[model samples]
Target: MAGYSLERLNFLVVDDNKHMRALVKTILHALGSKSVVEAADGADAFKELRHFPADIIICDWNMSPLDGLDFVRLVRTGKDSPNPFAAIIMLTGHTEMHRVVEARDAGVHEFLAKPISAKALYSRIRAIIERPRPFIRTATYFGPDRRRRQIEYKGRERRKTVKQEQVVDQSSVGLSQAEVEALLSG
Candidate 1:
């Protein structure tokens, strides 16, 4: 919303299904996005990354050979990842809490259930455009800070980095909390 333009932003849609890829591409185009890249799976996405760095990545969590989790882990933690900070959105059918937690830990910025709607997609895009989250790096993790803004919370902060409060560039390593809020609100 502040400095993002769909027509100017690059998007990478990763899925094993052709129809799903086409569907996402259509939605992106409708939103005025002109640069949309399609990847059949994580491997394909990895290859695409070499050619073009995406501003936003809409990927499915379930796939063959290279699943979304594997992809996210590699992207966020891989030493050779091109753009680790690129916003990642996981579009999947998995609705379990553990699965979502797994994805979040793998560095996914957004989680949208399958059978997605335009409103949900737009909301997520808006959130990323409006407010991106700070990136956090640790001995075992490299990605966006998983914590959301605490208006009021008495819960114990478990992560050792909770007190560090460090941030990295969006082009390097992390997902934005904006992505989660966008999907949740949707």
Candidate 2:
């Protein structure tokens, strides 16, 4: 956290609740981010993405007209998508395992449950920057790799024909002192 900075990154925050959006923006600012765009829902978020060129997107799971899951799918596979490879973090109150799997399958780069703290948010951002997962493309899926850990598989090889692409290179970004302290002390 000593040598890294969030000053250069651009963020887009999409949530139905205005309060949540403001809180996320405030936290981003406190984390040393200087640029953040807000959208009320996923549909509006798509519009913002067309112009904002956001480096990372923090979006809520629940919203009217267009939810986070749908938005992530569009971003990952839509023909009109501005950036299919943009990092996405899904924020939600639902902590159910199925919901997390659903978000992961929809192309989310990270998942942050509701009641989010600055430390949790900062850690998610840090993970995206420092340890970007390679994108996986298959007949039915095209998004960040869903697997978070690498384990030795002693079984048969399934989907050997699937192609995995490295979309984002490993980043050299670091965290701010405040973020480091929050992560360490918590």
Candidate 3:
């Protein structure tokens, strides 16, 4: 981590507030990031993203027109998205757990509350570089896996077998389907 420099990485900062954007840019520059672009809104950010190669995106949640949520959903699910796997970090004052969940479900790779410090920002960037999460696709979601890692977890299987599931769904007495449904409904 001592030798890692962010100068080679490109970043897109999206926020409606000019002051916030500048503040983030300054922080990034101070942290050894030289290639940073600013966007006033998510739409502009999305455009900039297509034209520029961004390794990470630091964006605000609330914005006019295309907000951060919209931008992430499009990027994660859109057919013409430039890079579906681009790492994204949400930096905003909104600290509500539901908002964080929304951001995570929308495909954001990281979340940082407002009043961000240089150390925190640098730590997040380093974490992303060091331990990028694997992407997952499901019937209802498409994004990086949301599970928190357990240290030294060696692929323990947790899924139940088909026969086990079938047994659990039914009963040992071999009750009729209607009888089971009636008992469950009660």
Candidate 4:
């Protein structure tokens, strides 16, 4: 139900391929996302993040300018944390074991293989949003506009920052516990 509501999220789709970026924006719109922003690559994504951080990011992995893994790391460890602590879903053509492992290590919340299917995209989006995990564990998690006025009006407020890195379970991507067991059994 979380992802089923259009009123819930503002999304960002980052991919080097123009068509793919457009396609993702279209899909998110269809899914009822309030606003969808597109970025050509990770650099453009960083600019967008600075201006208005998105609730979710669906990015392509093999980009000419700043790959998806670097983007994920940047989001996870950046000084000025991006809004909503974007739930990142990496889009990749390669499903090679090493590539998948590398992506997981780099902090991607979900994976959507290339030639994106609607079902897969919806599944991943819902998985990330509907999960019980806390979205962000920081005090200063709101947008700059909102926080700026608050800072100006309320001089100083105690901010709680968590040092621990969020590690999402691999099984949460799309595979159910039983499905993982079955895959392992085979």
Candidate 4 lDDT over 22-86, as tens digits, reads: 88888777777778888888878988988775887888987756888787777876776565357
lDDT of 1: 0.81
lDDT of 3 by residue, 86-132 (tens): 89988867766667678889998777777778876776687678766
| Candidate 4 accuracy as lDDT | 0.68
What's the CA error at residue 48 for candidate 4, in Å? 0.3
Q: What is the C-alpha RMSD of each candidate to the true structure, in Å?
A: 5.2, 5.7, 13.4, 11.0
lDDT of predicted model 2 = 0.85
lDDT of 1 by residue, 1-186 (tens): 464468989999999999999999999898789999999999999889988979999999889889999999988888899999999988988856678788888888777877888888887787777667878777777887776444445678555455443543434323345544544543
TM-score of each: 0.82, 0.85, 0.79, 0.70
Q: What is the lDDT of residue 93 in candidate 1?
A: 83
What local lDDT does model 1 show for residue 27?
92
Task: Tell me the spans in candidate 1 whose CA falls farther than 4 Å from its real position.
Answer: 1-4, 151-186
lDDT of 3: 0.78
**Each candidate's clash count:** 1, 0, 0, 1
Candidate 1 matches the true fold with a TM-score of: 0.82
Q: Over 4 Å off in model 3, which ranges?
A: 151-186
